[model samples]
Target: KQKLVPRRRVLSRSADLAEDYRITSDNVLHLVLKLSDLNLITVRTTCGQEIEFLVDRYRNVISLKHHIFQEGKGFPSQRA
Candidate 1:
């Protein structure tokens, strides 16, 4: 028999989009791995503009690095 590898379960948006579990701009989300119990993350977004996601085991990107908005309408483009 051939070896079997398990795939990571993706959190589908459809399943959580129902009326019972409506997703809002201020709602917080958690990504948990039921199989291995290894990956556990939490994400929170404000006004649906920016998000803050972090894993319990990692400490690399736990803060902001740049401005939330860089450009907008009638702004100059980056192309030459």
Candidate 2:
């Protein structure tokens, strides 16, 4: 599996968000979401021995912000 580190902090202008970072790995894929004034961009990639990145964008942003519901998964569990 590959790990996706959020890069939202490095974004200055909406145009700068129109880039994609590649992540090549096993059965796992990371989808990075970039928001634009009119739409959103989703960059899907995998991870390898070492992480890699590429410039890419999506067609819609609203779809990426959709609620992700996971069954049987409650809020963070309290530590004992």
Q: Residue 13 of candidate 2: its Cα lDDT?
A: 38
Best by TM-score: 1
Q: Tell how far residue 19 is off in model 1, in angstroms.
A: 5.4
User: Looking at candidate 1, what is the lDDT of residue 49?
Assistant: 34
lDDT of 1: 0.36
Q: What is the C-alpha lDDT profile of model 2 across 14-77, one tens digit per residue?
A: 4433344332343243345655444323332232122222222442334333321121134343
> In model 1, which residue pairs have backbone atoms overlapping below 3 Å?
none
In model 2, where do residues sit more than 4 Å from their true spots? 1-25, 40-80
> Would you estimate the TM-scores of all the predictions?
0.21, 0.17
lDDT of 2 at 62: 48
Q: In candidate 1, what are the lDDT values of residues 1-80, reduced to their tens digit?
A: 12221233334444443334554556555555434323344333332333333333433442222211321223444567
What is each predicted model's overall lDDT from 0 to 1?
A: 0.36, 0.34
Model 2: lDDT equals 0.34
Candidate 2 minimal-lDDT segment of 10 residues:
47-56
